[model samples]
Target: MPKKRILHGRIVLKDDIISGYLEVENGKITGISLAKPAISTETEFFDYGSQYIFPGFIDAHVHSFSNPDEGFEATSIGAAVGGVTTFVDMPYDRPHPIDNAAQFNQKAAKIAGHSVVDIALWGTIPKVDGVSEIPGLVKAGAAAFKMSTFETDPFRFPKISDVDIYNSLALLKHSKIITAFHSENNEMIVELIRRLKEADKVYPRAHMMSRPIIVETTAVQRLCEIAKWTGGKLHIVHVSAPETVDIIEAYRQQGVDVTCETCYQYLLLDVHDLERMGPRAKMNPPLREPETVSGLWQRLAAGKINYITSDHVPWPAEAKQKGDQNIFLAPSGLPGIELLVLAMFDAGVATGKLSPQVFAQLLATNVAARFGFKNKGQIVLGKDADFAIIDPSQTTTITDAGLHTRTDAITPLAGKTLAGQVTATWLRGRPIYQRGQVVAPMDYGEFVPGAEFGNQLAPGGDGLVFEA
Candidate 1:
């Protein structure tokens, strides 16, 4: 057995945030005890004083290869600095979309030696003949599978009909896998955008006007109906409105077996910011009114929302520089992988809007449990030694120069001051980020798939449900 070192600090575990000591041996937790002087003469030790030690966060929904300029390393560095130990990236527009087992393995081989932290991939299950690839892809280590209910590009994201959706779900019935849906009625939005553009009202507001609350609510309602009809596990990715959460809560009350997540942008920013930032704030399912933000916080406080992810998609300003033309031409997504954890801690914990347990549940535990990552999410003895030392009193202003991502676009929270900051992060008891810089091994991550709870979603199936 390897020798142990005692780390003393203000520790934040699953349901308790207390000042204590933690022992680590061979990159795993050994014990949690009250703070005291060392008994063994040869014992090694590190003290964090008053800093808060929290389990490293996991980004459940992210686009690893979305931004052209912000390549893999940039995103990884940003993630590390943000105290994220594992990133579950979607496989939508990569050079090789996950169509077959061969292509899935090819992409896995590409990311095998590139990441600095743990990674899980979301495979694309095309609505065509590619339905047969689900089992093989899962066996080959796909983190989850994603499909759009709306129409998408022919080769990239093929939309599936209701019959095809059920067919794919039936094939994956025994696999106990998670099926994530984009959750928008494509034909409705397409027609709305067409009419708005023809009427010469294609502004940023028009984008929101095109995809109304009914667009998302109707899709979510349909997904719940499908889940009730078929017992397939489903996850709704990147929810935008308060009404959506109400619907999800109601579904859970009715016992629907669904798990859903909302992004940081939806919780923090509002529609007024979009008017000022223009294309910078123009993301899919545009930000809603301030009352919606309040409703989301209430749900978050009540433990109704499952996870909080960054959905970190960073497109350079040059790529989204067409704000003058139609807003439809502008690319969606914003950069926040480096600031998500800090923002959540400050807004959720410091403000007293959420309990520390809710913070952990939304940021870590629920994500790990929902996705089936056996070694991640918790600070338990048998789990992976992934943690971050946070200084809640330290304040910083968000700015472009302070970021670590490859893209040059500014953060939406730029100029806003936030309390609490991540001082260091550890993966498997080895330091990956310290003193605001990355220090982890470069080739240090592996892919996880179809873990134990892969098919066992939350109890009251509340949220969008897609079969495949």
Candidate 2:
């Protein structure tokens, strides 16, 4: 570690944009000053003229290394280039399911150094009685635990019961952690799918029919109730409906420890686009009507939605297409990791709809606070020196040709111009990306667990049980 380093220019410090100099020592920010300071020995300086330095983004949800050859190192690199310095990935569909402490530890070791930025893992508590593994996964370094409301493949997904959800929440509450759920009603969606198939309405639009907006709102209502009853912190991920946002708002008003996150696709694109893009644009909690998209943006701009993420599940285009026009057969995600920050900045912040301060809160600070990432998401003294240097006035067209994701499913934002670009990104004072190119190796990354709980369990350690 160096004795000191100074970075100066337009700095977004502590949720405010102000012209100041930032000082770092021992890989943490030590000072922010308008007055120049005397240089210490071994001090280095980096001056980003006219560029804005904001807290590096925290992608709260993503999927990587979930299966053999399914990991996206190139997409993770794209994430670095796009101003994301920390990624929290979901654990499902992996060669090893992260249900127990042992599997969580094993996955951690597998991705040990193969990251472009700091990475964290989300552990899943199967809907089955196996949820007993929750505490152990947390001890093993899972910053948060995950459960799904909808069951996809019978073998891959275990339909969580009301009892199962409560037990898992109790376990998480005992472990002093938050539980995030994919809030879609499984039975309702299955019934709708059954009807759609019987009516032979099995088109891309039928997929949306099977997962009507009501499912999300209903599940959110149930989850919030569970959170209130258990006093367990809850976060609803990839919320796709306006009514669901209203439900979250109601929960918050009632003093429920509930927060919600929405994705870029929901804000920028509408359900109609899915017709053109076919399965590529399709995802769980499918895109909604244009009015719903507008309403989601309205809430986002109002700061009702607590955080933002890519939900970036990247599969190769060939694999995503799956030999048919049926959206049901297509994989459930698109690559938005690279575009998340830039797209949000372009569509939200630049439109005067969201202030830069709110951007910081939604994309970086809130994520760090929510996930307990102590040394990240702020330029505070003793905090990690991670930042995104953006040229707010610069314009760029989003295109797959320039992206770093291994897959080639182009963003719908292509041909749509954006007002800003991520010129550089730094992870703990090291410039890992500059001018759209990665300067670091895929394995140069490190697994960043919360400072709240250090590693007490290994990749395959025994599951820890908490007293109920």
Candidate 3:
């Protein structure tokens, strides 16, 4: 690629946004200039009068599973339109799950040209006995491994046993790969549902009441114990309850290798939203009450939350309405890839709960460092020149037309106007999403192979990974 320069913008740096221009060469940031430069023909330039340039957001949790209506292309379109240049996709795909080397390779090959932005894949153990296949999955280039304590599907998304959890942790110990989990006690949820059904009780609120605080706190507690026992690097995902945050923070203080991420919905919306939205707002680790919401916001400001994501699963309107009268019959999860960055910005930073810098860390920096994306998550010199141009002066009202998900375009964030507007998104110094369309080709995305696998572990490869 030829040299390129992005001129006359407010650049978001480590501590704060600065008035400056940037130079890129070979798809990496090579220099930063604080002063306005005279126009030159040495390089092509994309001029931004006064837009805010933020490190292109990286949503660490998303799903492009083999849904009939939505997959790599649809999700990538939503991602690009939403200003996300990079995302980590979950491993639950239809017909085939990514649990072994062959399956992983096949999925990687399938998504090769279908994405419009950079992507990373999360590998999962498809079944209880699948832990033995982690080595091959890792060797085939999985960025991280994901699992759930509660079963959504027996073979596709099973509740991993304690023995398997210990075994997975042991296998990944010192590997630098973080084993991520959807932490919630299976039996507790099952028994709660059984009791609710037997008592002839059913309501939207029953979903929240069934998975009480203990359900998540208990699973988080168990995960911490297993991780400590096996010396594994663990990450708890979609932590809705503040109790889970308290648990992970306390465990980290004790020196166990641990980290956790709260979903964007957890911080921005609550039980009332769920009650009003029903299956449309349904998700694992159900939304909490008002008081819990207040407490979570406080913790979010305190920096107890390591990062945030949109466990982005876009179920169709019919699928959500299938349960109809019964909340139990309705599937869990919702679409948020197009809403995450803006939602967080509107709720956190613009509202004074998060400083501009901290918000950037949550969406980008912390995630890159936690996982092993060596060149991502920051706007530093030599880093990949991925960025989202923000027009802070602009505000947008959420609507079906404004959204890019393949299914129901209406989101929990609909109706309300948000403060920041993403005008353009660039990946590796090249434009991917610009002026509300994907300018980059389907094959523009490159699979980032796991840096820990091949060359790193061969010969003088340093095995010291996941230390942070």
Query: Each candidate's lDDT (Cα)?
Result: 0.77, 0.79, 0.82
lDDT of 1 at 359: 79
**Candidate 1 stretches greater than 4 Å from native:** 1-3, 37-44, 452-468
Best by TM-score: 3
Candidate closest to the true structure, highest lDDT: 3
lDDT of 1 by residue, 233-279 (tens): 77888888778878877887887777889888888888888877778
> Per-candidate TM vs. native?
0.92, 0.92, 0.95
**Across residues 280-376, which tens digit of lDDT does each residue of candidate 2 receive?**
6778889889999988988887778999999887766777667245667777877777889989898878888888878888899999998888889
Model 1: worst 10 consecutive residues (lDDT sum):
453-462
Better model by TM-score: candidate 2 vs candidate 3: 3
TM-score for candidate 1: 0.92
